[model samples]
Target: MLTMPDVRAPRLLCVEVHEGRPLSFLTETAAAHLAALAARSVFVPTTTRTRKQYRRIHLPGPPAPYAICANGGHLLVDGESDRDWQGAVARRLAEQCAPLAEVLAHLERTAHPDWTRKLRTAEELFAYVVTERALVPELWLKELSDWAGQRGWSLSAQGSKVYLVPRPLTKSAAVAEVVRRAGTEVVLTAGDSLLDADLLLAGDHGWRPGHGELADQGWTAPQVTALGERGVLAGELILAELLRRV
Candidate 1:
């Protein structure tokens, strides 16, 4: 197992797990090894999808000690919110920018129904239908960006949904808070989307499966390893990196 020189006693780690996307070992032996490595760890799953939407996915047995839900809105323990932790986030997002209602209004107005599907918004993540990525007028997206910018928010095109999120609302920010509470000494993280980039970069070392948005864009950073793997490999990739740190 790898170790940072300044510390002893198996380092604590914070890991963000992306839902539905599999990392190779996560469903198999690799996850067990990862569990053995850290002093403690938290599974942070960031998704624009809500908690109920996430629940459909089968997380491996003996569930992670902690889990992040609602794209970082709900920090769950035994599948329930750790209110104190999640409340801090809601308070911050509330204070920081326009509400989800306003963002959804803009999305509905800007998005053409034919190209959009599954228009939904959670307390933490707000998104709407977008299809024919190349076909979507540049001006529309730009206008959306401008709209978000005015509200101190951001827009990202991930898969079908055009995400309108608060600039201050980030999976990384919420994950960091949980890490602090866990008193983790080192963090090992992974993900498969543009949204996961922040958490991955913040880790001591991060892995990106070749199939993901970031890797598809290309991995130029020394901090990120393009695993040339996807699905379960995406989950396994992160476990593999954490194994070395263990």
Candidate 2:
């Protein structure tokens, strides 16, 4: 086991980050305002997506302390990836289930050539994905589930997309590891998708923007404090509420 310093929750403030995608809605002016409230912060951006995808998008300012990438697979301190954390993650993946080679083989077979845009795997987290928004067939999700289940995996379909992931890999699980290292009083969390449901419930309290997978399905945790606001407004509202509780 990797030895770590004792960390108390940071007043329990957490957010499910879908890369930096949601932040793109806010103008530079609005983003600056939002960043100001969370200064000197430890932002745990939990996502099912990978770190490279998160880096592709830009946010307004640097998140102080650290920013989580790859759905918590990587906890970046001052923008540098943590080696020890990643090592532990690697160990978990090995013990968990299907190997990357096995998953990729299944992906290659079941994925449609015309619609498949990307086939990605994070060996550290033991996850795979096939994203094709416009080319999805009506029965794609059901078929994907059958394929994944046969291989002892799970599939999740978010808005305009689908994901193949292992049952042991979860965003909230990574966030919990970060919290143990942070040594704070609480954790505040937010997200708009079903992958985020775990993080929302895992935290002391959370916030859900007006859109994304969970919002569409009307999924809300009792403590998550779902916001009715939409788009940029939702981003603003979430930032504001997080500061209020902190």
Candidate 3:
């Protein structure tokens, strides 16, 4: 989390419970700003988290009507999977990307146990592993990216997690669907990770904090502003920025 001894951001009191314990927070100022934005505009959270994981976050606002979860593998409407959207996404992946099973098999064959800790598949749309980032070899990641690319997939390492996702499954595509449904002409977005690059690109304007994979890679587009804040402080600044624009 970003820490500044001289500057204090508002605290987000416990707003969500996970495994019977409190989790997920944003600044009090961010919470208020988001509430105001939600009241007037379409506010959709596009994330790489699975549906169950995403549900753990209780942002300060009315329940969002739409959310893109599983990095765009699933679309939730009123907290329930929209079957039509799911079907469309599945079809797109089937037509354009290699099967998740193929990628998972390759991972099982090539991954070294020394660094790989936990392997997971999200909605069978993508695969990822939690590994010791320092222990993971640079050449290995490059090789994996090259191998996946040929198979119509992409690999991204964010902190301790390395994701192998299908080329067709993306947050931007899901966000576009939400915009079409909402009939909105303007969009503002913020994120800090590589998974969010497509989303940031899809937005009219976007912000990225100075941490996460996108920051490490010096990633940006014409409409995206890269900020210097990191961690929780970055979240605060991103929300504050979004509020200012919306």
What lDDT tens digits, residue by residue, belong to model 2 across residues 1-246?
Answer: 112233621121123246433333453434665577556466655556566666555555565466676666687777678898788777776787676678778778877878877776663554455566667776866876887677666776765557666655667777787778887668888888766788889889999987777878888867978777666557666877776776
Clashes of each: 12, 21, 0
- By summed lDDT, the worst window of 10 consecutive residues in model 1 runs over 8-17
Model 3 weakest lDDT span, ten residues long: 1-10
Clashing pairs in 3: none
**Worst lDDT window (10 residues) for model 2?**
8-17
| Best lDDT among the predictions, by candidate number | 3
**Each prediction's Cα RMSD?**
8.6, 9.9, 1.8
State model 1's lDDT.
Answer: 0.66
* Model 2 vs. true fold: TM: 0.78
lDDT of 3 by residue, 63-122 (tens): 999998999989999999999999999899899978999999999987899999999998
The Cα error of candidate 1 at residue 84, in Å, is 1.9
User: lDDT scores for all predictions?
Assistant: 0.66, 0.67, 0.87
Best model number under TM-score: 3
